[model samples]
Target: MIQSVRQTFNQAFSPEHYRAFLDKINADFPGQLDFRVAETPVFVPKVLTDKLLTACNDIVNVITRSDFKTLTEQAIPEGQRVPNEDDHTQFMAVDFAVCTDESGELTPQLIELQGFPSLYGFQPYLADQFRANYPIPENLSHLFSVANNAEYLERLRQMVVGDCNPEEVILLEIYPEQQKTRIDFTLTEKFLGVAAVCLTKIKKEGRALYYEKDGRTIRIRRIYNRLIFDDLQHYPDLKTDFYLTDDVDVEWIGHPNWFFRISKYTLPLLKSPYIPASYFLSDLTDYPADLENYVLKPLFSFAGSGVKLHITSTDLDAIPSEQRSGYLLQRKVTYEPVIQSPDGLVKSEIRMLFIWPKEDERPTLLTNLSRLSRGEMIGVNFNKNKDWVGGTVCFFEQ
Candidate 1:
């Protein structure tokens, strides 16, 4: 974080200004902002920015290896494997906790990585709103590898709506309207000309998928997948013509199989200075003496579900032996509360967003989303009743 920029922004900050900023954002898409928006954007200095980039590149090297698919063959759950996976994942979101090392210097520790799409459409829009409302520095920007907002959005459009009519490509989800991140779905439709179609509503005619749009049955040629198997488990009674595992004739912008392959399961396969020690729970014959330094995580859950921060030997024993392989034990990284706020400092997690076109050797880092948390973890429930703890974008020194 840059102290001069922080001081300048703090001097200009006010409750009224934040209220008006929220008003403008809400006005753009009324009643769609279901989550909190932080009062400020993070000002990341060049030093920390370089470290984050290095960590991302290290992880990318492992992912782009020739035998990556073979190495991650078991990552896909038996019944959940989707057909027609692309040559590579179109999207990659890598999360890092702003931490301090033994020398108390700023550093980034890998938290998690997902081969899935993040707030691709909403992040740039949020950054624009932040810039319009705040005095962001001229030398700093939220974009990486891209020049401006138009260029960033254009790259996103090309990846999601490539060579196909936008109408034939839908942002596929289950009960998308009811999802918490529905604001992103609205923005994707606005920016890319694709509609958010729920899985239950999709009609399966033989091997082809179709969805009705304004009294017309439109053929689905591609899907901007936003659905997760964890969320799908919540609706067991609902009947659907098309299932994710079905061999449908369509292209997946973000293939569902990569979601598992590049998730917590892949954390153990990765080796980086920024990456903490991670191991499969099943493979550990003897539990570590300092169990407090580790956290137990389910291999497939999203948004920090089934994560046990405080671990005990008894907790490890409680898991059935056969099910232990579906979990991971990772060393916990101490999140340094670096972002200065009016109330107090808050810990932040920076998620680097990347896009990999089929022709590219690896994914390209585009922009980032940073969350300020005043609680034990970074999420809505943990940061409830807290100020300056919500979703926001980061402005990196250019």
Candidate 2:
């Protein structure tokens, strides 16, 4: 983290400015934000930025390798490949932690990587609002490239949907109104002119999926899928005519299989200074002596549902041998409370956004999302009742 910029922002910060910022946001989209917008932004320095990009390349090398399919098949489910798919994912996000190395220099460690979609619309829009209200320095930019928020989002849209009309592509989620990330869905619809259709709302006829918008039927050709099968299991009674596992004519903007394949399971295989030590439960020949220094995480669980922070032997023994294969033990990296708060320092985590264009050769870092926390963990529940700790983003040099 950049200490000078962090100190300057906090010293010059005003409650009135934040209130104006919120008012501007609500005026644009009323009732869109909850009480979480008042938190501080995560300031990422150049050193951590460079390290994160380097760590990403290390993982990308593995993903694009010749034996990558074989390596991925070690954990990925069989018979799930999209028969004859070629270059479908147009967006990718790799999250990293700003951690201190043995030499005490702040460096990035890879936490997780995904070839999936992110909050492309809201982040850039929010950045502009931040710049308007806050006293952001001339050198610091909310965007990664020379392109502004609109240009970047349009580029992403062109990469994902191509020449297809925006009306034909729908951002599909499972009961989006009930989702925690409904704000992102709404923002995406506003930017892309696509509706956020619930999975249950989709009607299947033959091999095509369609959804009704304003009582008019619209054929869904490209699906920007945000549904996770793990979450779908929660609502057993919910019915859907369109199924992901079924062979459908719809082209996926972010393929579903990659979510399961490149998630926490890949953490163990990735070697980087920015990534902490991770190991699959089944593959460990000997137990680590410092077991308390690690956290037990289910490879496929979303959010933090099945994570055990204070890990114990009894907890591991309780799981059946077959089920143990689905879990992993990740070394706990202390999130340094570097950002100065009114009371004390706050901890932060950076979510890096990337766009993999079909016409381009590699993934580009476009935008970012960050979270500031005062508690041990970075989630809302963990830092409840704490100040200056919630959803935020970084403004870096363009």
**Which one is best on lDDT?**
1
Query: Worst lDDT window (10 residues) for model 2?
Result: 79-88
Q: What lDDT is reached at residue 220 by model 1?
A: 99
Candidate 2 local Cα displacement, residue 394, angstroms: 0.6
Q: Give the worst 10-residue stretch by lDDT in candidate 1.
A: 129-138
CA lDDT of 349 in candidate 1?
Answer: 97
Query: What lDDT tens digits, residue by residue, belong to model 1 across residues 60-172?
Result: 99999999999899999889999888888999999999998888878999999999999988999999998888889889999999899899989999989998999999999
- Residue-level lDDT of model 2, residues 1-398, one tens digit each, is 56787777787787776777778888987766663764466667777677767887887766666665556665555544543244534677787766788788777766667766777777877777777776677677667764677688787778667788888998888878776677777788887777788888889899888999888998988888787777778888887897777778877777787776667877877777677899988887676889999899988777677788898877887888888888999998777767787778777778888776655666677888887877767778888887687777887643
Query: Backbone clashes in each candidate structure, one number apiece?
Result: 0, 5
Considering only N, C-alpha and C atoms within 3 Å, which residue pairs clash in candidate 2?
A: 108-274, 109-274, 109-275, 110-274, 110-275
Note the residue pairs that clash in candidate 1: none
Query: In candidate 2, which residue ranges exceed 4 Å CA deviation?
Result: 74-88
Q: What TM-score would every model get versus the actual structure?
A: 0.98, 0.93
Residue 209 alpha-carbon offset, candidate 2, angstroms: 1.1
Would you give me the overall lDDT of model 1?
0.93
